[model samples]
Target: MSSRSLPTRQLATVLFTDVVDSTRQLAQSGDQVWARLLDALDAVSRSEVRRRGGELVKSTGDGALMLLPSPTAAIECATALHAAAGQLGVTLRIGAHTGEVERRGLDVAGMAVHVAARLMGSAGSGETVVSATVQALASPAAETYDDRGELSLKGVPVPVHAFAIRQASPPPVASAPLPVGDDRDAVTRLLRERRYEEAAEIAPEVDAATLAEALLAAGGRVEFLDVDITLVRMLQDVLDRLPADDAVTRSRTAAKLAFELRGDPSTAQDRRDLLDLATQLAESAGDAQAASEALLATVNSLWEPTGALDRLSAAERVITLTRRTNDVDHELEARLARLHALVEVWRIHDAGLELATYARLAARLDRPELNVFVASRRGMLAQISGRYDEQARQGEIAYTNAVAAGMPDAERLRMSHLFPIERDCGTGPDLFEAGLEMLRELTGIMPGNFYEADVAWVLLTLGRRDEARTELARALPPLLTSSGYRWLFSAVLAAETTAEVGSAEACQRLYDALLPHQDLLACVGPTFGGGVGERLGLLALRLGRTDEALERLARAVGDFDEIAALPWATRARVHLASALRSAGDIEGADSRLAEAKDTARALGMARMLAQIEAEDGGR
Candidate 1:
């Protein structure tokens, strides 16, 4: 500490701007004309830099280097210079990077300066490109940055995540505009109103920007309204018209269309095709961030029984690509996707390990919104390990941090995970009442039969057999199709409900559905109830297969013990006792019951404890 010198480096935003196609312009206009233009551009650059609170370090004949205090200032100066160059009958290609730079006598020297030059070299004609750092530091409203993904600059030591900067305004219309003002607004309003035929009549005449806007507006009404195929086709047509070399625009458009189409079952194949195209375009252009986004969309739409392995593979690819981009936010999303896939395929141990690595990397970002996601995964692990205290703590951190971060979907995001913890170990409200309320709120927000199985289980726990049966009936159909990521856990809850009141046919159907994946843990995102073996055993018991029930239940007991999931272990023992009793082993039955009752009482598992007492009373 004593030997270390005071830090000489200070943070700065370094910017570079060069005349686009200067050589061609020089050859076409002669040296005198080009020289005069350069002089005027240099004067304009210096003036703009001073106006935006920056220092024009020096001119490089055809370009200039500048130092600014902030990314926003740098971008404003760049935008101003671009306009000024336009007046002088020239165009510009600009780049910016925000990082620590060493001041060198009215100049700057560091990786930041070098990286800015590299970025400028990568910029297309009339475009301003910035490193991910600059994009992150600048206000989002300062400019419109189209992510160009991870680019391999010629002299840069590492790949950089770059974005092309545009002014914060509506996308420019095509060279030949169709309708203007009120006329264009009419078509947009028609599209939003779901008048597909009327909108489609004018869609062919509309510009790409207008069509994209209408499509997004229509897509956002997915829950209450349906997206017309005509609208999708219109946007696709515009995307097709884009130049083949415009990979960034193409990839982004395709990805956006695919995402919006996800809620439409009829567009399953369309979504797949669009996502594939997006990935191909991005990859061919060496745009890692765009590729990562396309792959993430694919993984998010996965629901088929055989898709887990594919999902894991895709998620890993996304992580690799996003890491190259050096975009922490996207990388975090990719890693979380990978974590979910690992859990889905029953690689719980691997998921736990990866989560640890994810946590360490996320800590450096200091983003509370990201922290909420990390905490939720940790809570899931805690649930599996029967560490209810830790689970509750993590849940609180996630909820509080989500609120603190002003995450709009904070409640919806954490509700499903939090409900389970509250149901199992909360000291606040009556478990059943609070659980029912939370489920209702979640249903209101997400709608569908998404929570019907959960509702049925809660009802069954409350001894409302008739109501549980009704909800269970509503919940069964989605099990046969794609119910998204929560299918396995929903199946688990449905299986538990079926054990009590289901017909032999229903039990057999669920058994067939669950038996194929007996090796995987039955969990939904971060919520683990128990192993699949126990669920299978319970269904077997309901089907009167006592011998198979005994075998499966015994295995489930061992599984619970191995994981130290106290609540699940206790419940498994209770089920094992019933199986043993059915098999007519009185001593074995009583011993298992005694062990289960002890754990239930100590853990304050009132529902399970009541079940044990009820069984004892019947005996």
Candidate 2:
């Protein structure tokens, strides 16, 4: 019934994966244990296959034959599954081949399948390998993949472009978690992490009385996921037994409730009521810090827009409470950072200053960790002000110091890319190198996806399109991607670089097509001559909307002007001289071109001048 007389040809990637050492593992284990392991493995495999757009065709014995919509997805699925199942002593090898295939029976059969099987044969024991057909689909995003020239397949007609997966291995300490590590101080560390509920969980796991004694001394926040309502009620009961004047204990209780209330609506109203009571008790005790903590708990239940103003008023109450009771604690500093993040989004400058004062105060406190945090906040403020250079300089020092002191990977990579953008090349190359290295080794790390895109941008600027393309290729598969927007922006910039280097109409057409995305416009525009460059480009194309160009560029100083980009937004002009030239005003064109060059000289963009010279060369 589903048969069609005519069959169409398309490039499809076929992947084959077989559980490595599966039989050995089973033979060494009890049959029951092996059975559970196999079932779980199959479940994970099936879910991953479906998510990656791979259609399962057959599962005979130890291996499965799957048809993937794209080669990239096949590789990604293979790499991730290898990591996910490693704990169970199950590893997988994937081989992908993309080419024309026949739709027959319940599956697609063709040379692509045979080649794919062969490719799989060529992969390392636990590696994922890819063929050339998959690599050629480069129009969507530029990717970095090494070209392994023609590989001789047993029966496939020719050699295919073959590549291998590369991933960074975790350190010896992190390769696998231990059954029990040195956790005598687990409750204290949990409290320090603001994981109140987690602290409570482990508190029982350890000595609860000792944990409680330690928490009373350590003074930290708590974390509670809202999924367990019964657990929260139990935890709340425990908190109710604690002394009201114990600030850290009260803060931890409030924080746990806040996380729960923010995440779930079933107990929202009740939580709000509890928070208000907590606030009152805190206020009555002249404990504004505790009251502010309670107010944060209340804000979570009302985070939605309809009640946001109410939450904001509550947030402001923290600042007011701090001022009234004069609690100069780190909580006040964090509250300021929190409020600034909110007000900055609304473009409220006065409110931002009030928030910034707290950052300055925190910086003066001089705790290394708090200083690092405050510096990062200042960098964010600088970014918001469009002073990207300042952001990079200040943020880089803090992030670098943090990393030197063994800060997390997320913070390190953040500073790396920030430096490159601000033209602080000190750490730029190393940042990109580390980023790419991470992508290859720990592909499953959530933040690796982000670092890949950003590092790709820097690589592109370095004239390493080929290298950048490799990184993009590894990251841009549509499987569980948050990389789409960045991919789009990167793709266009790559295309623009091609256009800028040559006068090719094809390159120009690609740039012309992608000009509409506002982010892309903003990104490419500021790097060039002036604001009018885009309008002038449009005017040159003369795609029949003369009025649009005329109206848009009317704010220009003249037709042939280029001094429009600036630190001098204080003074700039646009020009329509070129448009008039196309409209038959030769004298006006000469005058405009002269003026534009003179203005560009004043603006001091070396490349911008070169572009003008190249345009003259073409004429």
The RMSD of every model to the true structure, in order and in angstroms, is 16.4, 19.4
For model 1, residues 1-619, the per-residue Cα lDDT tens digits are 0000001123468899888888899899985566566656765676677766677766665788888867777877877777777777889999888764543212345456777888999999889898877787676635567889988866443478889986643212211111124345555545544576787888878776656544543433323124445756766786877678878667767866665454454566776787789889999998886787678766654433345665578778887887787766556656766776676565768889889978898788644345676787899887776676788788878777754543323454466566666555554446676667667655554444357788888888777899999888877766644344456677888899999977788899999988876866755545675677789999999999999999998988887787567788888898999888888888898999999999877876665677888877766
- Cα-based lDDT for every prediction: 0.69, 0.47
Worst 10 residues of 2 by lDDT: 1-10
Off by over 4 Å in 2: 1-255, 261-281, 284-287, 297-314, 363-370, 396-433, 436-619
Q: Write the per-residue lDDT of candidate 2 for residues 1-619, one digit (tens) a residue.
A: 0011001122356778777776787688865565455545544555667776666654434566777666556656665567657866777777876654543212344456777788888777787677654655412222355456768867543356587656523211211221222444554444433455766665556543444444433221111112344345535655665665664555545444444444343444665666666677777777666677666554444432223344556656766776676665524533643453243123335445754675566567533344444455556445433355666676776666544432223244363335424332132355556554544433333231233544454566556877766654443332112111122333333443332232344334444533443111211101111232343344333444545444444443432122222321211222344455456666655565555566456644343345445544543
Worst 10 residues of 1 by lDDT: 1-10
How does candidate 2 score on lDDT? 0.47
What TM-score fits each model? Answer: 0.61, 0.37
